[model samples]
Target chain A: MERRAVFKSRWLPYALIAPQVLLVFTFFYWPTGAALVWAFTLEQPWGGGSAFVGFDNFAAVFGDPLYWASVGRSVFFAASATTLAMGVALLLALFTDRQLSGYRAYRFVTIWPYAVAAPAAGLAFRFIFASEAGILAFLNQISPGLWNPSMNGNQAMLTIVVCYSWKYVSYNFIFLLAGLQAIPRALVEAGAMDGAGVLRRMRDIQLPLLQPTFFFLLVINLTESFVDSFGIVDIMTGGGPAKATNLMVYKIYFDGFKGLDYSGAAAQSIVLMVLVMALTFVQFRFIERRVHYR
Target chain B: MLYRERMGRAARIALLAACGLVGTVAADAQTRTKFDLWQGLSGDLGERVNDVCKRFNESQTEFEIVCTSQGSYDAAVQNAIAAYRAKKQPTIVQVFDAGTLDLMLSGAFVPARQLMEENGYKVDWANYFPGISNYYATSKGVLLSFPFNSSTAMFYWNKDAFAKIGETAAPKTWEDVEVAAKKMKAAGMECPLAIDFDTWQWMEQFHAIHNLPIATRDNGYSGLDAELTINKTKFVDFVKYLKRAHVEGWAKIKTRATGATLGEAFASGDCQMTQFSIAGHGTIVKTSKPGMNWDVAMMPVYAGTERHNSLVGGASLWVLQGKSKDEYRGAAAFLAFIAKPESEEYWSTVTGYIPVTKTGFAAMQAKGFYDKPTYKGRELAIQSLTASEVGPLTRGVRLGGFLQIRKEVTDALEAIFSDKMTVEQGLAQAVERSNATLRRFEKTYAGKTLP
Candidate 1:
């Protein structure tokens, strides 16, 4: 039975929640409202004044083919990064949950990469995968012109997807591991006594029970990969040898900050936010039905 | 209620003390009239800027110039714009060449001529080389900003490598460059010419030197609604030639994409010849291998065409408006001090930037400054800048969204080099994209015209 606490003083409860409400309003709602206004107006770069353009900025943004290309690239990046991140994290979580020897150290090591900031990780990966004078340089000696990410677009995409997945894998592993541990140990032992192998037990007992955690990670990773891959893309590809890696978030930054197109970038932000919100809504409405919860 | 009253009294006492401290600081600020200058470069160049401020500070007691580096040119301008919006902008800022139009259109600064003349300084505006001044001046021939850290493209060749390939002098034309590259390759030089595909070096500078138009309306100096002309120029031929060079393996790509810059590739002797700014002279000297012999010359022109002056690539100083009288005086004084021939020589000597005025170049020559091995070959930059009269097409690009245009050109180059798009297709596509950007900029400032 769930117990609910009743407040004797109605005003006291409102006061207790006021700070949180104020923070959300100030940080999230205020900036979002400002972005909405900016999206419909033409902003002067030097702040002389802005004019009300009324959907003109959005019209311009949607009219550009390059903007649409960025949307496609961002979708590809998010899907690839999320699927790769969750698969790797689930694998590692499964390994650690088996209570193998030195599992504590392995768990600690797995979680360590999550603490690294995104850009720093991107820079480290950039040097490590550098074609000419990096750890991968030996591949060039073995097969000349084989490991050139700077020239090739597919290789460039793979590089960022790998880097972003590496960073997020640790985050997913922690959650998945906790969820794995929450399952009663007797459930697994029970499946094993029914003439089932380890993989069989994992498929029937562990996999079905872990669906809730998997669904939660899926929604979080997909939404975050849309926006949070900016640092990785900025450091590694910088939107490309041919705009191959120009994700929507990085494009927004480049146009607004470097190109000084404020209204156009604001329109891009609105599109990105709407896209992410729709994605989350779809995942909850359809994908959540398949997720089994106790 | 008694405790709260006691706490309020204590807080009021602290606030009074804070106000008193602020008053003293404000009084000190008034006495010195310290003004801010936001420069766009850092490291060794930043230290040189700091040294200039220190020298100026020591020369006077009435005003102090506080110089700060905002990392890169993009950051400096972006931060300055933000600061302007907040009414906290600096007195002076260093803006790069591409930003000239945006600043010129924004009406945000006091013209250098007006500022200098108002401060009782007789600036010989004509003495500023036409090639340098034309880039910063208005259509009415009014100078908009003070030229600072000026540089132009020059061809840097490895002397010893050229000698091994039986070349006695640096290449003066593209055919000569190709001949030298072929000879070097035969002589076991793997990467004969290192190319970075920098927009300023390849697209803009190439167009300027070839006396070709990059955009209509005299490269956008005539109007805000100017369109691009890069597709209808000799640039298409240059791209075809570059593509051929890449296919033949004589021109090796050297940029951050390849994990080595053109300057680094030259310094390490991985490439025999490079085309970059004269400002790279100092760093190349320091980083080159011991006993490595190198010299620089003016960039090559096509065999049939007359070579025009190459556009200056570095930044210029703009005196931002809306500062106090004392602050403006301090800024004018600092500008005057830096404009003297000796100060120009000192700046050029340390930083490898060419002196902006003819007098500074003459002063350096009279003193045999270029005869020194450390400073040799840098004179070619000045020669290249003054190679011909500043033609309408060669003055400089003044279009808004020029930085994006440069990026578009770079993307075109990459696509061409990768064989994903033909040279003609890429150039034409880039011109289309650039025109779109221009149209958007035209809409942003609908009623404004070029000053």
Candidate 2:
């Protein structure tokens, strides 16, 4: 049987969703449309008028070596942050799924980090990892200059990655926990009747069953790592000791806001939007086939 | 009951109308034109800016000035640009030194001289310090902005630390700085000479003191096609020197995250010496521990060249266009009042910035303003900026996109200091990148020439 909530007046449905449609059109589609226009034109630095220089801005962005380097760095940042966040989240979810003491408290504590803003989390991590007057400062006291993130590129990158992962872990944990709880005890019991151990049962049954949740978390985490690493990179290292943590998003902000190159920044953002869209597309097309919905 | 309610409502309406009439009449009686001033200063600096506006408002009945502090220098300039585009900019904006070129080229500003003259005020344009005036002047030598708080780079060192190291005098040259830094290091100073993240102390001060050009076309004062000449100059040698100091543990680079202001380190006796803006003197005097002896000296020049004057580092006030005539008059009155010797003395004495005009300097000296213990070494800033006659290059640097260029230079120096690249390669790459940005800026302006 087919069932639906049919409205007597067509205007009722429209009126009900008017606010959402208005918000999406005003905020998202409007800005996206403006960025597209700017991406194709060369804007005057100060306001007067802009010229239509189709594809020139994009060409300039693509030809820059610094842009290419930042793209490569963004991929590394996203991949590492996603993997670390999701891996730790999965481990915590699996452990908390068991009958443990203060399970409610543990779940609450695990999800608390996601509530903190990214820049605040980055600032907190910065103090902890600072070369002077921080925990790392104490570590450096034992071995002089051991953890100077200010001067060391690798250490700077590590600081940004750790800060970003710390924020995303809570988000991944919630979905993973729900997925773990949704798995039936009968499936594990059946595996046990087949003389399988706890680890073996989890490997064959629970792991396969949790694929959809894992896939969803992976996509969300990867997209987040790509677009939202700006605040972390900005507060932690400012894309330095020497552009060490110059993620694409930070580059876009630095070039646009600080550098005041509007057209170039717009062009770079256009590229970023397309890149993210394509990445999401590829994930759904290839990886979705393996995800078990039930 | 209905009749009583209606009567009460009518009485309330009559009272409201009477209050509105009185409010309008009172406002009309004052007949004061309101002017908006947008500045980039907060905290102590913001207080000083507000104090000036308050004083001006109190001194007059015809006009009122309202000042708004927009947090940081960069924020002020960026916001002003956005506001100007939206045709909602204030009458006056305080733009920092690095943003001078961008503001000059924006074409949305009425030159300060023109504004004042049009409003029937006569200002002694030549009374301003040449080093300060030249930075904010047109190519034809006309003043374009009112220099409010001007400062120059100088060296500050701890007197107690020097005494402990058995050195009585401040370092006068780079070689002397190196020797003093080594002695401080040997004397158990952890950060012997602290380096701030600001590249101006290293690049602009060094180049100006050594009488070297930082860019072609008279350091971009002549035209828009000025390419950076830093790579060709002795700036590389200076970078190499700084890098060597860092590697040998005599110098520590202080970033904001690292809590690197020299004032703190000097107060704690960790850093023996530092090079920073003379305006930082006020901060040190205010924040440093009691009885922490310190003095300012001229920035260290190179070994061979005689020291030239250093360029100014503080901000200036510009009159933006597209404002009402009444607002312009109010702004002009405020500027004229601020240019007086009394106003200048109050500002310079409270802040560490030097008075921009000769008359202001004279007035402050006559009143023994610098005779106080807290004002010690404050005069070194004036001396440093006016050490010699202002030359073309020493006048100031004016280049489009200089803020970004400065970041590039700082990044390069950081890379070199961190051993990620050699000094030669880093400087060369910085010059190349800066030139590219300059070319883009030139293209943006197109057929028009930079004034």
Candidate 3:
């Protein structure tokens, strides 16, 4: 009799959620399943037909050195960008949370990059870093041979990391700020009364409290860096000076669209999906327990 | 509360009925005479295409051609494929040379010859420039696509930069180009010679200019069975020369893949000389600032071999299958209208593309269109194209998966130039990889073959 009453109480809420559940199944689940099937087949050249190739595509991708190189590049770029973005965002959040004068304006200015479209932001960075007529080139001219991002691989990577971090810092900052705000002021005051210095308080009280937000931000940042860097690379170096900038997504695009190696592209995409999912699962399983939400 | 609730229910019922009627009407209207057309030309080229469509629409009463610009040539092809899969494909599309094989094997295009003949349009297949037309035509000498916006590679030099370097004449040969580069370097120019899309200009056209094969089986035009011929000494020598230039700092590799527009770079005084498509003349003229003197010249030639001509680098209008007869008629009419001598002359004059017909060229000459100083060396581009030795190699390569093979070649070139691999090793690897791609493409499109 008690269970029946509980079920009746939740019935309307479950009915209200049914539409969203159906949509997710149809759009997300269906397409993802289709993509998995497609990864194993060869699309007919004339269209509307496909043939199963059993592991041939996967074997081809693994055997090709170019595919592996692109995977390596993708991981390198994602790791670097995520770490840099988190570091910058955390610092900015700490600074802005201090309640200093004009901090509102500073916060607004810092978040401006988030407003720019990814491709547009990428284009602006490209213009700034162009080899001959770009702003960096102009600066080099004035300085009589300054370090150029256009010519050097390390410099180019650094430039891309900086641009990516600039765009996402605001996103991370919002989360970190909310996390900071959620921490009880009483706890911070209690720590100070116990002779805990600012660093010590941050290390013990603030960091642990902010763990959940940081965890969430880390996953989001990793996915963004992995999947969304293609637009930046496309608009910026176009995977060039010589392919020093060709990330995994860019490689998939090149193979599928430009190269017409649909099978190879599909294989690479499957690998990318596997890698990202593995990382996401690891985070959820291993790190979620340590995250202090309250 | 009862009266108000009753009124709201009635209003909701009326609104739902009206919305349902409107949706049905809109769906019906969408199904009528809607022809989808895709083109790669964005910016100015796209604007001109739109204008032409507008005029065609005004001139016609039965067909409405909806032309959409899909960014670049490669993107346009990809869009068409996606659309085909969705069963919402365009009736006519502008596909570039690299996509020729992909479209041909797709078996989805109604060859232009058949389309026109079935629609009762008077199309003289013989009138087209044989060298240019044959590149996209079927094996039985049937036109597969309407030749539109055809262009050949040409030399572009900054006259002011050359003058500063004390060179009054254009470099006539590859040897002269090297010497001029040295002179420009001595004169403090940053880049004396920079070619855009290095693989296309340096390797493909270099092979074409020397009448050397880029691939076997008559460069894939004979059949789907083809293999890379980069192992040839001519190709090796060309790569050697390119490496020498790179080492000497006379030639700087562009950082971008689409490459820095050679014409724009020259106009900006960042580059002294470049070899690019003649079609870029319009943009170069428009974008050149005050006191930036520039001129066109013939592409530099190798010293020993015959100065073979370059192939066209522009898009062709292909008629797709599954369109209504009326729509096919409209497409044929539009193609014929554009190919007419007077219309061709106007198009060539407006957009720096070479006329596809001898009559069009004659008409332009009759009007003294070539007399303009701005068009001084453009005739050389056309003349060079005419004299091009359409040998087995220079004719133009076609294969089941030429697009993918081209990417492989590009990848190999990138690896070579980046010092990731040697030129010899790169060529060998490109051949091995490209052959595998060709085999796969062949298997996928097995039953389809040129008649």
Question: What's the TM-score of every candidate structure?
Answer: 0.91, 0.90, 0.90
The list of candidate 2 runs beyond 4 A from truth reads A1-18, A96-99, A178-209, B1-32, B257-259
Tens digits of per-residue lDDT for model 2, B1-451: 2354465467559868986877865474367888899999876677688889989988888998988888678778888888988889999999998888867877889998889889999888999999899999987778899999888888888888888888889988889889988988897888878885577888988888888999999999888999998988988888888888988999897775574456677656668888888888888887777877888898888787888889898899999999999999999999999999999988987788889999999898888888988886788888888899999889889887787788788888878888888989988888998888788677666666777
lDDT of 1: 0.88
Q: Which rank order by TM-score, best down to worst?
A: 1, 2, 3
Q: How many backbone clashes does every candidate have?
A: 0, 0, 0
Tens digits of lDDT, candidate 3, A1-294: 344534456688889889999999899888777667767987764474678888877887788777777778888898889998899899888778866788899888888888887777887777677666576676656684365555456667776777788899888998898888788999999999999998898889988889989999999999888878877776776675446787888877777888666766777788888999998999899989888667
lDDT of 1 by residue, A98-176 (tens): 9999999999999989898887788788877777767888999999889877878888899899999999999999999
> How well is each residue in B1-451 modelled by candidate 1, as lDDT tens digits?
2354466567559868986877865464457879999999876687688788878877777888989889679899999998987889999999999777777878889999889888889989999998999899997667899998999988999999988987789999999999999888888898999896688888889999999999999999898878998889988888888789889988988866566789999999889998999999999999998999999999888898898999998999999988988789889999988888988998998898999999989999999999999999999899999999998988888887887888788888888888889988899888999998898888888788888
Which candidate, 2 or 3, has the higher TM-score?
Answer: 2
Best candidate according to lDDT: 1
Question: How close to the true structure is residue A257 of candidate 3, measured as C-alpha lDDT?
Answer: 81
Q: Ranking under DockQ, best-scoring first?
A: 1, 2, 3
Among all windows of 10 consecutive residues in model 2 chain B, the one with the lowest summed lDDT is B1-10
Mind giving the per-residue lDDT tens digits that candidate 2 earns over A1-294? 779878999899999999999999999999899889878876665574577888888888887778788899899988999999999988888888875888889998999999998777987888788788677788777888787888888888888888899888899999999998899988888999999987897789888999999999888988888888887887788888778888899988877777777777899999999999999999999999878798
Tell me the docking grade of candidate 2: acceptable
DockQ of each: 0.52, 0.43, 0.29
Q: What is the C-alpha lDDT profile of model 3 across B124-232, one tens digit per residue? A: 7888877688788766456789989889888888888778878888888888889989988887888888754446666677777777788788778777877788766
